[model samples]
Target chain A: MYGESKSGMQCAEFDLLMTDAIDGLLTGDQLSRFEQHKTACPTCSAMFAEAEAGLHWLGQLEEVDPPVNLARNIVLATSGLANEGARASLRSVVNTTPGRPLWDRMRDAFSPRTIWDHVRGTARAIFSPMATPRFAMSAGMAFFSLSMVFTVSGVKISDLRNLDLTPRNLTRTYYATEARAVKYYENIRLVYEIESRVRELRRAASTSSVEPEQENKQKNKQDQKSPKENEQRQYQNFSRQDSASVVIATFDPGESVIGESARQRRKL
Target chain B: MEDAQVVELLVRRCIAGDAAAWEEIVQRFNRRIYNICYRFAGSPTDAEDLTQDVFIKVYRTMASYDGERASFNTWITTVTRNLLVDHFRKTKNDRITDSIDAAPGESEDALPLSDRLEDTGPAPDAHLERRETRELVQAALQKLSPELREAVILRDLQDMDYKEIAQALRVPEGTVKSRINRGRAELARLLQRTYRQVM
Candidate 1:
């Protein structure tokens, strides 16, 4: 691919020089050198001929018309993009435009009524005393008065010397005397004895009633032939006992004794 | 309108966001820009797309235009050349192929020489021969490298002088002349080959 070189122009340089020669751009010394090289070099000569022929041929090509819609399409596309930009810009302008008057802004800054109201509110908040302590004192007084009324209504003072004394009455009188005296003393001994006796009686009653109630429930269950029926019978017995206990607790002593005798007869 | 006046008005309206003026600008240069793009892309469709792209680029960068440096035509041509070179680099997979055809709307009697003759008309055979010669020239022009192609298109097709071509291409005048010469020689060889093939 090497060609004749002249005046420091190699093959590639020679080609460039030959192009320059064809284009009539080479200067005095370069022009003479290029001409000498072309005269001696067949490749440079051919290249020059080819370059001329090519330029001549290029001069002949017809300039074709583009598509008819080309300009219209471009305009449409660019217009669409531009219109969108314009709309965005317009929106920004509208958003940024001042909506309020200068007087309105000034009035808002220095309104006298609002300043006075704020000052009044601050003064009230700083100086005003809370009513919670006074309300609490009133409530305490009402509570103390209610308690005094209840205590005075519930208490009665009888003559202390009228308590009775015969052998059976002496035993009752002694118990009454002991009961009155017991209120004055610590009386741990009597209270302990009463508690122990009540506990013993409760244990005995529970032990005696549990077996009978269970036996009755079992018998009722056997008669009914179902556990649910036995449970219902047990619940009925418990309800009867609960009602009787309530009646006994609510009755006067004389009525209670009579009711107990009647209950004992019924049991018998 | 005078070219300078039209350019000035269009530039003013374009800056003012006048779409109609922008469209007139596009219409005015569409053919010329398309021709430049066609010379680079060697396909009408690609050329059309590239021309549209060039105008879009021009519109975007118009704000940066400093009128002191270059004429509008030279600026646009430079934009087109740079865009085409970028397109060539991006789409290296598809080679550009040029096919010769008659200019659109140009009849047989409307050949360049015939038009120059001032006879108002010419014989059909002369026009056809002129068209054939034009096609041969175009086929030859397609054989050049991008730089040489740019030089030839600017010099011969666009009918710009070496100085203008050099200014458009940002090259020395001597370099532009050398490129044109090399490009023309390559184009001649291509034309001969094509002629031989046709024969």
Candidate 2:
């Protein structure tokens, strides 16, 4: 009880109202009583004045701005605790499951509640940033595109489950791959042969047409030669042409034999 | 929603293991807590460390919070105060009680605290630079006992009301007021005796 004494406002009463007086909260009768007490008592008056000055100095002591990393450090520290707490809680839950038959416990392990909790936790941990609707939609579209590719590639999920990895099957697969590669190489070689033959025929026709006089001279020389020698010369010329075609096919299969022949004819 | 309701929801979210909610709580209160620590510990580095320790304690014990009993602000202030008191107890023996006659920088030729001050009471119009006043006040505040120091800090510097300060200190309202009165008187005396001109 801080009632006024017979002495009229003791030091205790003055101390009681000091804060309110300094804050200007005292008014009317209380204000009058406080002012009278302050004037009547030197100790109370000095204490009151000093308190006001103390408040003034405190007002000057501005709030010290925290370091810039304070909030970040706090968050990092607490978030680590939160994660540990979550893990601890999970362990507690798992540990507290009532003892039961292994089979029953196993069944309960797959229970919807347990599964849902695990799924929710995993989602929070792994996909928290991807929880947006836009991200979900993008994820769904990507899954659908992957499914389409699998279907087009004839890759059934069942087929994946039943894949044949036996040695015999592996051997068959290896031979099949080898056969396919050989067939591809043969096709390329056939194309090269056809192109080279066409170029040779075109060159032969062009040479005869462009230099008939030279061809006639060659024919006369052939006529003058013995038949056996002429046959030997023809065989030698055929062998040289065959060797050139083989060299072109081996060294640069993609080079155009027709372009080469045209350049050769121009030089001749 | 009102601010009280918003804070209540945040508390619920934090209890539900929402890290972002906890982060928001830290963002809202870190500066206040740091300032309280700064006033009590008398150094920024110590204040920073104590602020972190306070939050860590709060985080671990958040489940014990009862909203119906007190606001988050009061509870956090209580946590910060408790941590500061604990730290003081730990480092109490290490603190050097400098003699009043000791010179600045401990040099013999330098002026003592009492000799360096201007011989005048603080004028209503007397204006010390903000930084100078802050340094003078902080020095005076550090001279008070922990009990009195905390009272004035929460009351005047922190702007907490009597009820909030009482709750944070776990003391009666009357005791809070009495300590605040004594604390302020002592602080004023310290400042007036030493840095009288800067008041």
- Winning candidate number (DockQ): 2
Compute each candidate's TM-score over C-alphas.
Answer: 0.48, 0.57
Compute the interface RMSD for each candidate structure: 4.8, 3.3
**Residue-by-residue lDDT tens digits, candidate 1, B1-199:** 8896678678657755677788988888889999888876666778889988998888766655544577778888889999999998898766534333323223333443223323335545876668646544554455567898898888778888776788789998778867877777767766566566554
Please give the interface root mean square deviation for model 2, in Å. 3.3
TM-score of chain B of 1: 0.77
Which residue pairs in model 2 clash with each other?
A: none
Candidate 1 vs. true structure, TM-score: 0.48
Q: What share of the true interface contacts does each candidate keep?
A: 0.64, 0.73
Candidate 2 ranges beyond 4 A from true positions: A1-7, A84-268, B99-128, B196-199
Model 1 lDDT tens row, A1-268: 3555655566666765655465578899777777777666777777777777676566567677887998897787676446434433322232233555766655643467434544654555444433358867887999888878867888323432554544898788779899888775757777888999999999999999899899999998787777777788998997788667657755766556656656655664
Candidate 1 lDDT score at position A163: 47
Determine which window of 10 residues in candidate 2 chain A has minimal summed lDDT: A87-96
